[model samples]
Target: MAWLADAVVALVALLHVYILVLEMFLWDRPAGLRAFGQSLDAARASKVLAANQGLYNGFLAAGLLWGLWLGPAGFGVKVFFLACVAVAGLYGAATAARKILFVQTVPAAIGLALLFGARA
Candidate 1:
């Protein structure tokens, strides 16, 4: 179960990294524009902002990976980052897109649940 938690955490981190790449590197590209469903002009207009957002996503991934690297001692770190992800997802869902709830919040929620269950 702990392994499962770790796996989920790792996957979340990877997901964030992928987002980072999409937003930072590809936000103005066809891939990023398509993924975000933004028009090319809009993507170009907000490229800088998207890159900043991507950097933050990279930070989130870094934090999760850091927690994982700490082994059992990283429980607090994992929880904190997962909570951040959940909250962010919720906010995004409310303001940005409903899909965010399923994409970001649910997975973090699942990871947090597995972490708690593993502890139990």
Candidate 2:
């Protein structure tokens, strides 16, 4: 059960890493533009902000990976990071796009559920 939870955590971390790359390095490129559904002019104008957001995503990934590295002892760390992801997802869903609920919130919620279930 714990392993499954950890796997989900790892996947979420990897997803964040991918998001980081897309936002930071490719925000104005075709792939990022397609993923974000923005015009080239809009993307270009927001590139700097996107990079900053990407850096935050990288930090979230780093925190999750760090928790994973600590094994069972990192339970609190994992929960904290997952909560952060959930909150961010909720905010993004409400303010930015509904897709964030599926992409970020759902996975984090599943991971959190598995984590708590494993403990029980």
Candidate 3:
């Protein structure tokens, strides 16, 4: 159980890091645009905004890593970050994109449940 929780946290952290790269560095590129289903012109226009969004993802990743480093205390950290991700996903789903709900929030929610249910 502990191992499962740890693995989930690590995976979430890795995902966030990937998100940071995609948003900050590749938002205007073909890969990033395709991932988010944006046109090249649209991606180029939104590069700065995507970079800012990427920074937030980096912060979330940092928080998860910090929690992972703390071992037992990592539960709380994971919950907090997951909640943040959930809220962000919900907001995105409502205003920006529907896919955010499933891709971002659902996994975080699952990980949060696993972390909370794991034996400490």
Candidate 2 has what TM-score?
0.99
Better of 1 and 3 by TM-score: 1
Q: Which segments of candidate 1 are over 4 A away from where they belong?
A: none
Candidate 3, residues 1-120, lDDT tens digits: the string is 877877877788788899999999999788898888999988988899999999999999899888889998677887898889888889989998999898788888878888878854
Q: What pairs collide in candidate 1? A: none
The candidate 1 region of ten consecutive residues with least summed lDDT is 26-35
* lDDT, model 2: 0.97
Q: Write one digit per residue (lDDT tens) for candidate 2, span 82-118.
A: 9999999999999999999999999999999999999
What's each prediction's TM-score? 0.99, 0.99, 0.93
lDDT of 2 at 89: 99
Q: What does the lDDT come to for candidate 3?
A: 0.87
Root-mean-square deviation of every model: 0.4, 0.4, 1.3
| Residue-level lDDT tens digits of model 1 in 68-118 | 999999999999999999999999999999999999999999999999999
